[model samples]
Target: MSERVILTTSSHLEGYRVTEHIDVVSSECVFGMNILKDMFAGFRDFFGGRNKSSQAALRDARITCLDELRREAEEIGANAVIGIDLDYSEISGGGKSMLFLVATGTAVKVTKV
Candidate 1:
């Protein structure tokens, strides 16, 4: 099996040196809430409580986007991705809403320093 790609939010690794810089890699994930979840969220909003469904959806989307980002880095012959960034946004209209997540980073080949 292939090795897993390492991901880091820092520009440089602690004990590794970047030998080659590859192209930037990014991944996006979109998730939509069902009517039940929407209703729960609305109720939570009115009563002032945590929305578990929405939180779970956001967490799942984040994980999916990060996994896709790692795959993209591996495809380009990169063993690691540095300076990773994640962005989240919500799209809503006509009584519908979706969560959009994006993961971006610089793919690079690294060696032990």
Candidate 2:
């Protein structure tokens, strides 16, 4: 069985789902990744005027956050994460930099139609 299945927007399948709660599903997820462009965009938001520190901070944040999400999915046996939601926040303290990400989705096993 394929460990990771990437579903296109138009592709119709029976095993993909996006929701808060999933009950009685058998699957396994390996990891999740973002395209390079998206990683760059996240950094741009952190940097006010294309600064290096902000760029580096954002990169680290994204990596750390995604790692946590993937870890959670792996623990629960997810083959592929669908309906990804991104949440970001700016640090409140003066001169502080940080961001947060939470990924939630359903894990299901797909059988041939």
After best superposition, candidate 2 residue 84: deviation in angstroms? 0.9
lDDT of 2: 0.45
Which candidate number has the best lDDT?
1
How well does candidate 1 match the true structure, expressed as C-alpha RMSD?
1.1
lDDT of 2 at 54: 48
Residue-level error in angstroms, candidate 1, position 49:
2.3
Best model per TM-score: 1
Q: How displaced is residue 59 in candidate 1, in Å?
A: 0.8
TM-score, every prediction: 0.94, 0.48
Off by over 4 Å in 2: 1-48, 94-97, 110-113
The alpha-carbon lDDT assigned to residue 33 of candidate 1 equals 81
For each candidate, the alpha-carbon lDDT, in order, equals 0.93, 0.45
| Candidate 1 per-residue C-alpha lDDT over 9-108 given as tens digits, one digit per residue, 9 for 90 to 100 | 9999999999999989999998988889999888999999899889999899989999999999998899999999999999989888889999999999
